[model samples]
Target: MIDRSLFENTETAFELKSDSELERAYFLFKMISSEPLVRIGTAATNFALKAHLPVEKLIRATVFDHFCGGVNEDDCLPVIDKLYTKGVSSVLDYSVEGKSVENQFDNALAKILKIINFCDEREAMPIVVFKPTGFGRFLLYQKKTEGVVLTSEEEAEWGRIVGRFDAVCKLAKEKDVEVLIDGEESWMQDAADDLVEEMMRRYNKDVAVVYNTLQLYRWDRLDYLKQLHKRAKADGFKIGMKIVRGAYMEKERERALDKGYDSPICENKKATDDNFDETLNYILQNLKDISVFIGTHNELSCYLAMDLMKTHNISKEDNRIWFGQLFGMSDHISFNLAAQGYNVAKYIPFGPVKDVMPYLIRRAEENTSVSGQTSRELSLLKTERKRRKL
Candidate 1:
């Protein structure tokens, strides 16, 4: 049986965090716990960034440093090496978002290819991540998802997008690195899913080289996974998945309401949690055909995964299963799991300070909106602080 209190070990969780870093984390979470402060901070930061009023230094020292690995891949090496010392791996995430041009798309593809090469060289980094929209325009994906016929020009553009995906996934396969394609909003997800499935069929013939993100908060995802599994089995391929409760909850619900369509999101938090756990169970039961990266910060879910693995006679260090949390959040879950000899990886977001603000702001807003998330982080930091007599 897994220990119920494994995640409460502050010393193991904060061993890498310096005394000042612990205090900074406590202060950051305390500030993030206030919804109003988060809203105001997000607005002010965005305005300051647009105005070019020199807030980048302040943001870099505070939230950016805490949440992100660094501004570039080279800058992230030290951070990645340090985490690996604790037996945790890293997925280098190039987090620049919102590109609309072909040149920008090519740049994103080049960055990912470079990261895959980087991952190949570094023992600490076995995976790389990119968003579907990062390689092409969001509307292109939306058009494809809605089954709308595309113009010749649009088709040519999308062909380039597909080429970009192929380049990265092909390189990852050659280098023996895993590639994770992040999931976006429900409207654009279908096209992305179809594309990722193709990549999996091609590169996952021998092993899982391509992973698709499944946002379990979407009520239809478990069915989607099962269907994908059946197809993979018949086609002689493996299914690689990174499952999460999801981001974009507010946007998804609001869009569904505005369009008078049923929300794709589960009806409530309990339903989403149950859906995540059930999906986790399903993946664990089919580990031979499916490899999962369990992306969550919930301790109960982590404990549940541990218990299930034990029940299934799976070894703690199995390569087919992994636990992942964001770089700045969920130290308790990530580090504690690593200490217990489970495969754990941190998603380390990196980009220029200005370009990464949107990702960081969203992280803060999500922490504030998710009930008890910020409080748990603050409580853990406080416990560590008291233990160190700070």
Candidate 2:
């Protein structure tokens, strides 16, 4: 077993932060912890960006700097190297979202190909990630999921989407790097799943070069995991599964109500947490057929995986299981795991600041620790600050 004080070593956790930066992080987290501040700040920030105001500087210095790696791939190299020094690998995520055109699709494809090619050379970089909606049009994918018959133009658009996907997967296979297909809303997820499944059949025969994300907050995902494992054994291909608690909670429930369909999400956070842990156990039990990236911020779940690894006598450096956290959040868990010799990676997202604002706002709102004591993030910062006496 690894040293447990690694979790309490706030000095290492905040090593990259200056005293001023630490204070700013505390102030920002405190602001967003209040529901009213987040609501007003989100609206005002959006308005400023849209109205050609100079809020970009303030934003770049605050949330954007904290959550995102850089404004583009080249800009992230320094950050990537910094993480590597402390034993954490980087997963370069192209963060541009909500684009829907052939050129944009092509650009995203080329960008991911660049990431994969870059990963081919860097030991510090492990896996690469991209969302289905980043390049493909959301409405078109939603229609395809709903089984709408596509006109010829829409069919051609689908072809472009498929080509872009195939191109990325093929390169990943050739380069011997894993590519994670990030998850999105349920309405369009089936289309994305179908595409990822096909890619797996083509590239995952010997090893898992392509991965599909499963959000365990969905009530059906446990059964879905069973079906996937059974199919993988029958079909003779490994399944690369990245598991997370769902992201689009309110959006999923709201749309289900509008459409008069039963919601796909778990009824409560407890159910989601249970299902996530159960899914993790199921995957670890069947380790040969399934490889998982435990993409979570929950501390208990992380420790549970550690205990399971110890029970199974799995090596700390095993390639089949990984721990992933976003770049800025959960530093104690990430750096501590890395220091303990586990395979740990940070999802390093990069893009134009405006294009990445949606992602930043989501991080801000989701991380607010209004329920009780400070958030795991805020408290860690406080601990580090007190240790340094800055």
Candidate 3:
């Protein structure tokens, strides 16, 4: 059996971090553990950016440098290479969000396509990711999700969105690089699901070239995956899924309350954990037909996945299964798993500092909201620091 205490090895976990970097990680998590600080800091950062205050350098040096790889793809090469030396791969995510223009969509598409090309060239990068909204407007997706009829102009615009998805997936297929399409709000996910399913049908005939994310915080996602599996089997195509506990729980609950509808999110954190584990088991049991990218920072969920893989007799190096964590957090899980020869990748968010604030702010808020997440990070960093006598 694999070592149950594998993740407790601080030496293996923080081997790549220098003394100063370790202290920085500890300090960052300490700050994130306070809920009020995250709220006030988020507001202040947003205001500063809008008022043209010179906070970009401060952000870049501290949170941005820690959470993000760099400001662009080329700038990320050294980080990508560094992680690879320790057996972890990198997924370059162009994380600028909330754009609603044709040119912006085109720029996002160009960025992803370029990242795919980078994946093809670099052995350290085997996968690329994009958000559905990155290729089109959010309202367009919401309208289609709610079954509203689109005007002719909206239809033409959506057609461009489809073209963008196709262009990336096609290049990904040609280059043999895996593509992960991120999940968003449930109010607009139906349309995104249909579009991604179509991409899977086109590019995943031989392998899972295009993957759709499943935010398992939604209780219905396992059923959704099961139904999608039936369709994939009937149609003779593979399935790729990146499953997460989700990133928008507060927004989801607020929207449900405002609209007088049942929340799509699981009733509570425990339910979400159960849902994630159940889905993980299902995917591991059906690994031959479905590939999974397990995106999580929870130690229990990570352990559950490792146990499931062992019970299913799956190889540690299986390409169809990967364990992923965000770039700056969860180094214990990522490096420990990689040290044990399990397939692992870190989602490395990259963009200009000002443009990436939304993503960074969300990260900070999520760290504060998720119980024990920030504390676990701090605890691990402390352990590593003590081990190093820092």
Cα-based TM-score, every candidate: 0.99, 0.96, 0.98
- The sequence of per-residue lDDT tens digits that candidate 3 reaches over residues 39-91 is 99999999999999999999998999999999999999999999999999999
Model 2 TM-score on a 0 to 1 scale: 0.96
Clashing pairs in 1: none
Expressed as tens digits, the lDDT of each residue in 118-162 for candidate 1 is 999998999889999999999999999999999999999999999
* Stretches of model 2 off by over 4 angstroms after superposition: 1-6, 369-374
- TM-score winner: 1
Each model's lDDT comes to 0.94, 0.87, 0.92
Candidate 1's clash total is 0
Q: Which candidate has the top score in lDDT? A: 1
Order of quality (lDDT) = 1, 3, 2
- The weakest ten consecutive residues by lDDT in model 1 span 381-390
**Which of 1 and 3 is the better model by TM-score?**
1
